[model samples]
Target: MTKNSAWTILAVIGAIVIAWFLVNVLFSLVAFVVKLILVAIVAVIVYVVMRVFVGGRDDRR
Candidate 1:
């Protein structure tokens, strides 16, 4: 193969590796954000349930 063709192949491979690494990092970030949102939603639901069922007492401390 010509030197130019060999260099082109190497560049393509390097690009693919970089793209793969970036995609993995992106997915990890997305997963963490999704987990955080889910936890927040569940926490809010639990808080509402507690307020409704257990209720806050008007009694003095």
Candidate 2:
């Protein structure tokens, strides 16, 4: 293979690798955010349930 052709092939491979890495990183970030949101929602639900079942007593002295 010619030098120019070899360089072009290498460049294309590099671009593909970079693109793959970026896409993986983006997906990971999205997954993490989704997990965080789900946890927050669950926490809120638990808090509400506890408040409902455990009524606060008003003892003003």
Each candidate's TM vs. the true structure? 0.86, 0.83
Model 1, range 1-61, lDDT digits (tens) per residue?
9999999999999999999999999999999999999999999999999998777754677
Per-candidate clash tally: 0, 0
Best by TM-score: 1
Prediction 1 TM-score vs. true: 0.86
Residue pairs that clash (backbone atoms under 3 angstroms), model 2: none
lDDT: which candidate is best?
1
Off by over 4 Å in 2: 56-61
- RMSD of candidate 1 to the truth, in angstroms, is 2.1
Clashing residue pairs in candidate 1 are none
State residue 12's C-alpha deviation in candidate 1, in Å: 0.4
Off by over 4 Å in 1: 56-61
lDDT of 2 by residue, 1-61 (tens): 9999999999999999999999999999999999999999999999989887775554565
Worst 10 residues of 2 by lDDT: 52-61
